[model samples]
Target: MGFISNVTGTLSDSISSELKDQHLETFRTDSLGQDILVKRAVRQNSFGRNQGSSEIISAGSKVIIPAGTYALMIDNGKIVDSVTEPGIYTWENSSSGSILSGGVKSVMGDVFDRFRFAGEVTKSQRIYFVNGLEIMNQTSNESLHLPYPDPVYGTLYFKFKIMFSFRIVDPVRFFKKTGKATTVYDYMGSPALPKQPFTEVQDHMEEALNLCGSRDKVPFPQLLSNKSKLKDAVNETISEVWYEQRGMVVESIAMTGLTLDEASRKRVEQFDSAKIFADDPAALQALVALGLTKAMNSAASNPAGAMTGFAGLGMAGTVAGNIQNGVSAFGGQSVTGPETCPFCGTPLPLQKPLEYCPACNADIRSYFQGMS
Candidate 1:
């Protein structure tokens, strides 16, 4: 048979064959002129042959030329391979040409190029503000009113210097969920100025500390005695606030230092003084003793002095004696002793127990007996 007639006969036979029974095969030539077979289903325009050095025309088979390659001719459902370089080739669908081109390339070669979709990345970290830590972020004028003004507030400016660290956990989720690393910054950073102003996180921290202080009604001196506990309470409250509100976990919070403003410091010092005097049983007892002595001396000097001054002494002595007896009953020491005549060291009698010294006959007791 002649070359043209033979090719036509083959084409007719292939075209007439049932597609369900016969499968079509595709081939393309490399730069080395090696024929490589690519298997695909037979379809319209599935055949082609090299019509020229740079082109192949297919009449029934679809073909994939590499990104920078060309096609020449087509015939039947088989590809007549003829080419001049190493590149990707696939059987293209006439209806969905090159739809699976990448798939074919991946099958034939290593598909190492990867595409990833990322949204946002977020990181969480912990900060520590040690006890007595002075925070620099707070403005000098800003102040918090703690419930126990004596222990925590009163013209006191608190400042703390804190250490903070952060790390990324769910990078993709952080990016997608939060949108930026700064989301955490915004969550933790100081709020705006003027209305909220710049208060150290430690200020809030201290406030939380003072909230726990409310559990005790004792004075500041008593609270300060357990300063370690105060610090722990502060750390706990601040950490909880951060975790619950911002969805960030706290690793550690410490207070590096604690300070009191000048005015508050002075007030605290004064309070300390008052506390010392108020708490001293000995001093209180001495005051009571002196007053009783004075009344006894007076009664002794004025024989008929109506004894009113001695009456006050008698009442005070009774109350003091009862207090002493109660203390002794409780295994505690007595602060005051018996009321006596200042002139002779003799025990006095009340008018109700005659408020006068019988031996020295003195009048000496006029004084305030309750807390001043």
Candidate 2:
């Protein structure tokens, strides 16, 4: 058979074939390196060739690590060869030795020694194309439930929809922990990748989610109001986790939506409705009094709206009297003296003028202060 047909057709697909020197030099992925997602949680790549994708690096394949690509050779589940820099490289049966000891210079062959590996090219070696791109594209959407604190409502559970980008800073560590690599040979024909690396990636995001109640602590009410700063905090907090784990460097993250649970949603609705009244009862009362005054003034000018307002007030007063009478008639007997709360008309406890009404949680002491 001619050398062209032997190298081009037969050698490309067959792992068992012995590689010639020319084939070794030119062998590489058709495209650049790839982003291989780690979803298995098992934290490792499979042994030899994924047939699913378009690219699969067969055994005895020569590979050149293209620019922006980091390639590795895994033999029997061990990383035996790797090319980090952009260059042409042949995957030898053994490493040249560590650069620190100067063993690499001797192992790197002159132009002539490339003809043989020992005597012939080693058998059954695979090449993995790793994207040296600074940030890894997210393989899937990430959602998490995180605890967020609020000054008024305490801690609220929030549903965070997060998307992040990262890069492989330490390929060896990533491989050691994740055990994931892709070649052009497998079923997929590209790199055999894990299903959802972002899932494990979320393990590092807890501190950012919990907020530790500091470092841009976002209240439930302000979740949307203060999104930009909150995302920054999430990035800062999650970045800390990646740095410690040496898993991957977090390039950037975006929180698309931060939502509240059912209970928190209700609480926020109540807060929106009753904010002025809850924050300052006295002010609420003053506003009512002012409305009544306007109604009385309108009675002289145009008696219709005023008559309606006065009639409403009369019914309200009658309802209030009935409620007070009922409380007095059926409620518990006074535990303390006549320091009754103006709001609940409940007897006060030993907390004195500043005490709160147990029945209604009214600030009896503040009421008394106002009276004085």
* The candidate that achieves the highest lDDT relative to the unseen native structure: 2
How would you encode candidate 1's per-residue C-alpha lDDT over 15-109 as one tens digit per residue?
23211112222444222111111211222323442211111122123333342223322222222333322343443322111112333342212
Candidate 2 TM-score, true structure as reference = 0.45
Judged by lDDT against the true structure, how good is candidate 2?
0.50
Query: Once superposed on the true structure, which residue ranges of model 2 sit more than 4 Å away at CA?
Result: 1-67, 73-127, 134-146, 178-180, 183-196, 201-207, 212-216, 221-246, 255-258, 269-372
Give TM per candidate.
Answer: 0.30, 0.45
TM for candidate 1 is: 0.30
| CA displacement after TM-score superposition, residue 287 of candidate 2 (Å) | 6.3
| Residues 1-372, model 2: lDDT tens digits | 587765544434332222211121234543343434321111112443322211223323345555766666665456776667887664545332222234344323311132333233333234456665654345334467876667566667777765556666666666565465443222112122424344445664566556634555566556565646655565566554454454466566655567779988888777765876556545455656676667556654664576786676665544444344434443434423445555655555335455655456665655666656
